[model samples]
Target: MTGARRDSCDVAVIGAGMAGMATALFAAERGLSCIQVGNPGGILFASGLLDLFGVHPVAERRLWRSPYAAIAALAREQSDHPLARIDASSIRTAFEIFVAALGAAGLRYAPLGDRNRSVLTSIGTIKTTFGVPLSMVAGVDALEARPPCLLVDFRGLREFNARQIAESLGHRWPDLRHRRIEFPGTEAAPELYAAHLARALESRQTRERTIALVKPLLGDALAVGFPAVLGLARASEVHAAFEAGLEMPVFEIPTMPTSVPGLRLLGALETAVSARGVRRRHQASVRALAFDREAGTAALDVEGVPGVERVVARAVVLATGRFTGRGLTADRGQVRESILGIPVLQPASREAWHQRDFLDPSGHAVNRAGLAIDDAWRPLDADGKPVWPRLFAVGSILAHQDWMRSKCGSGLAISTAWAAMEQVARQLRGTGAG
Candidate 1:
């Protein structure tokens, strides 16, 4: 066996989803050396709208204008929910630092406030979310005002039909109209993707050509809405050019999953953490994790890249995401924690996992199945104690919360990460390891 020394750090964060990224970011910002692992699947599906809380008391589908109020209700109603455990001030500070980092990485957001804003989606539906990218903020105002607006789409872009969107909501918003035009340079392609169009628009010539085509069509349009294809790396510049050329407010409605906004979020988060000096392992998965009880460190075996690599850290943060990210696995009998096989707090049996009616308004019991943590955010074993003193868990993996239904996906991920990182900092530094 090679006697080479292995890489060491203050923290090893598993799962490359938003929660994992936040954990690593928070750790690094607090002066802890961190290494993060996992693929980028989670962030790629994001809509780039950070939802703190929109719906609460899932059974009633109650929507809230102020997320702070929603949390207050959640705390009083569902005290066991992970998000309820995080105080309001810490959550605010967490979002502030998280968004500031993203802005620095070229993804600016409108200043966050207590109230949530409604954004138009491609399906003619409105999504209530807190954090809005500067490029998409105008869409919020346009939707609220329902003024004369032109919804634009390219000819070959599937899954997004401007006319359908306008028709669906036209009765309620009569001033809304839609127009379809051929993209400047994609006449022969027969099909187009948001990411591809976004990259093309980064070129001044292509952006100008596209703007010229839309300029003549903007007859009485006070606002212009396009698919979220402003640009990839230079989205801000491309968005500005469209707004300037059209002499009106230009906004983008986020497309379905695997979109340009999602790509931008993934890239920006990666850049943000990397810039803060956090090490990363992209397209990699952890093979095994073991704790050195005497040394107070964790050892991880990761599989994916060239050779099987090992990582050791003084503390470990399990940000491994839920089902989609494969941080939790389910069988015919139970949903088990993916990496460590820790006891997952799930339904009594598979039979009870879901309601008899698939569309039950309250949602399924299994949706809340995940690791149960203590006050310090450490995942508990069967005996109801932390698996390890230096170990923690964050994000959707925590039991007793349904991020999707609550519309607090980013908040759950970011807030839990912040709250847990605080405990991690204290434990490590309290032991003189920092």
Candidate 2:
């Protein structure tokens, strides 16, 4: 550690998942010199929908119309839940800020409201979520109205099958129809990917040709729905052009992951954080982290490069996420925090990790295994004390809640980052550390 290259920042955020990005964005917004470490591989799996709260009492799988109401109920019943612990107003504000930042970065979302909207998935199933991207907002209205609509899919795009979606929902709306068409220049191509198609749509020629092919298939349909592949960076323009050319409300149904929307989301976040002066180490991972009590700073050894480099920060936020993101690692014995070996609150034994049934109503116990944090958002050690004065944990890494089943992943990430950064800023200013 003696001769390694070193840099200092007001805050060093570990991980580049939703939570980590939010932490860095908020930290930079507060004028904190921020350093963000880790790859953003986790974000590529995003569905592009910001879910605040959709299901509560996850055991029942009950869906809620108003996220605020669901959050209130969770607070009353499951007071320890992260989303429940945060006030509705704060959560709302956090979503607003996060969405606005994305909008500023060219990934605009529909105006967020109090009620949750039902979005049609690529598979024809409906999903309840709080915030809908502008490109897909029309699907919300189409779902509510159930008007005569035409669903279109490219012949080579195996991920999206318009016929399948139409048939799946045919019982509910008999008038719904579907068609498959050859993409403008992919007639000879046997298969098509959403990302490539999204980029192609950005070209005027491709957009017009694709629109011409669909215009004839419109028939009696009042609206048109396609897979979420309008455009990559220029989604708004492509969506607007489609609506004008088709002379109808056009919408996008979110396809499965490794999708165009996910890519767009990641790009926008990177843009937002970078615009705010947050240094990125997207190709790096934190190898070792040590806190210097006397210096009131934390030293992080970032790997994934030619040589190790150290980053010193007044405060540190761990947003490494859950198993998939490797924030928590598992073994024959128990789940352990990936970094610093912080105490993880898991089930008694591996036997209790899962129930006999895969689809258990209450969910598997391992989904709730994560670090336990105190009120200040600081991860607790074995003795139930803060691991460090400025060490904080956010997102799915925290225990006592199942974000996936609860359908509050975005809310948990954004709100916790916002709350934790508030404490970080206050502490730094109070101690005159930054």
Candidate 3:
């Protein structure tokens, strides 16, 4: 690896989770040159439902229809929570920009509004989330009206059971019906994968055949629901075709990851960032990150290449997620920040991390552990000072908020990315630098 290339940019975004992607998108949108590192495989696990503060008071699991109201409540009760710290206007702008970028990349979402929308899940559960992809939007209306709905599933797809959903909701929506048919070409296959079925549906033959199978079973149903196996590349087109062929409202029920919508999101984000001229190092990660205090710059040692390559930039945004993304590591004694070894704010000891009962209403204290950031979004040292002039932390890597319980994962990522990038832009210009 003698010829390892070194690159420079205005910003080097560490990690490629939702937050990192949002940060890169924002930075690039601002006309700042950005080099984004790390693979964003985690997006593949997303349900494609962008949740923006659906629940508050984790112990009670209180769901909110108005995300703005939930944010206000969170601001009052948990002032330090990341979502609580940002202004509502900034949050709205962030979501608008994020979803707009995705839409440009062919992953259209329902228009953002003041309240959260309820979307159906493959397990027959209703998830309250903010951004619903256009392919799944009709289900939102169908669910609310409780119309004569028909749910469809492929014969070999084991993950989605249309019958299970129909049975579970039997008492409430007796008009709901479910049927299964062999996917056009996967009839002989004993088991089917959603991604494969999705890719296959992109073909006109497959889409038409699948529609033909479901059209006969439409009965008097006003709308039809299917496990989300629409086309991978052209999902909206495929979904629209289904509605036109069946002459009914067609919606998709999100299944567990790795999901078709997740794939679309990942592809759309990549397309959006690439279109904005953001340089990406997919499947690579930041091995080491350091700042040159005198130069007013940060440097990264990127791994997963033939050899370590260097990336120098004016600023860096850490969007590495929590334990799941390996941004925060834990041991028997304590938790540690993985990439930069920044001090993590955590419980007194591992023993105090969890409650005696694993199912305690209150989430474990450990779940809320991560880097502490200044008001400006810079990661703070143990003495509560900025670790680096231009270093910023966003997403689940920030401390004092349990995104999972609060259902603000997407909001926290997108909104904070917008706010932090604003700070980055302002600080860079103030210093007469890019």
Candidate 4:
């Protein structure tokens, strides 16, 4: 253990997904020293559009124009839900701060409001989300008016198809047209990826050439849409250039996962948290965690690059997420929390994990299985008491809520993180630790 290093902070965050990132950002903003652990690659699954609450009562598939109204209904119907426990004011403030941090990192968004916007997906389906990136905001308007628009795609980009999108919405949007063009300098390549195309567009010469190719193709079209391959780091500039070169409103439809938008989102978040002075263990994972009840601190064993390093903090926030994040694991018998053997709130038997129908509207029982938390956002032990005074849980790792079906994944992450951090700060102040 001679080569191993030791560090301390006010808070140590586990996981680098949206929830973990939000927690670290909020902690740093509140003058708390923070060290974040786990790989950030999970953020690649994001679509860049943040959903705050679009659906309620998963069984009914009811959509909502206003997320606050949906939350009200959710609180009335399902009081145990983690999201229902948070008030509307706090949720709004959390989103505002989160979005502003992203904007400062160069990823600007359209102004947020009380309503959810309808965004067009790669497969021509409309998704209701609260926060829309500026690059994709035009699609919301185009989708609303059903205007005459041109959709463009590259020849070898397999993930996105402009023709398919037009075909899917043909009946409802008759004037929507589709076109395909060979991306400049990629004609020899048999397959074009979204990330590569996005990087290529960052070069002004390449961006101008691509715009030239599309300008001739846009005839009598009020607006134009493309697969979200606008410049990766300099997306705002590239998007503006396209609208100027084409002399019309331009939009981007989110493609499949591992997309350029996801990359941009991750990069901006890293920038946001780093600027606020949060230390990051980008290549590390927590091997083991122990709490010193009498000392009022938690020790984390982080396994990473050189060797295993120890990180102690006055408070620890678990945003490790669910099955994909390995925060909760299951075997033949039952599901259990991954670290520290915290009791997981799950089905009584493995047989009840899923419903008879695979596509049940209510979702599988297993999807809602996770660690149960007390009123202060701390994970509860078997007896329904907080395991530790400063050990708290946030994000999808909490039970009694299915974020995917409810369309509140981002909401659950950001809002709970904000609420939990408030408690963490207050508790640390009372204990006078760090």
Best by lDDT: 4
Candidate 4, residue 348: how far the Cα is off, in Å:
0.5
Residues 1-434, candidate 3, lDDT per residue (tens digit)?
24667999998999898999999999998999999998884798999999989888899999999999999999999999988899999999999999999999999999999999998889887889999998899999988899898999988899999999889888888998988888887768999999999988899998998887878888899999988988888998998888899887889888889999888999999999999999998878888888899999888888875567888999999998998888999878889899878999999988889989998877899999989999999988888899998999999999998888888889889989999999999989987866
TM-score of each: 0.98, 0.98, 0.98, 0.99
**Candidate 4 stretches greater than 4 Å from native:** 1-3
Pairs in steric clash, model 1: none
lDDT of 1 by residue, 21-133 (tens): 99999999999999898988578989999999889899899999999999999999999999889899999999999999999999989999889999999999989999999
**Model 1 local distance difference test score:** 0.92
Ranking by lDDT: 4, 1, 2, 3
Question: What is every candidate's alpha-carbon RMSD to the true fold?
Answer: 1.1, 1.0, 1.2, 0.9
Please write out the lDDT profile of model 2 over residues 40-97, one tens digit for every residue: 9568999999988889889999999999999999999988887777887778778899
lDDT to native, each model:
0.92, 0.91, 0.90, 0.93
What residue pairs are clashing in model 4? none
lDDT string for model 4 (1-434, tens) is 35679999999999999999999999999999999998874588999999999898899999999999999999999998998999999999999999999999999999999999999999988899999999999899999998899999999999999999999999999999999999999989999999999999999999999998999999889999999999898999999999999999999999999988899999999999999999999899999999988888899999987679999999999999998998989999988888888999999999999999999998999999999988899999999889998999999999999999999989999999999999999999998854
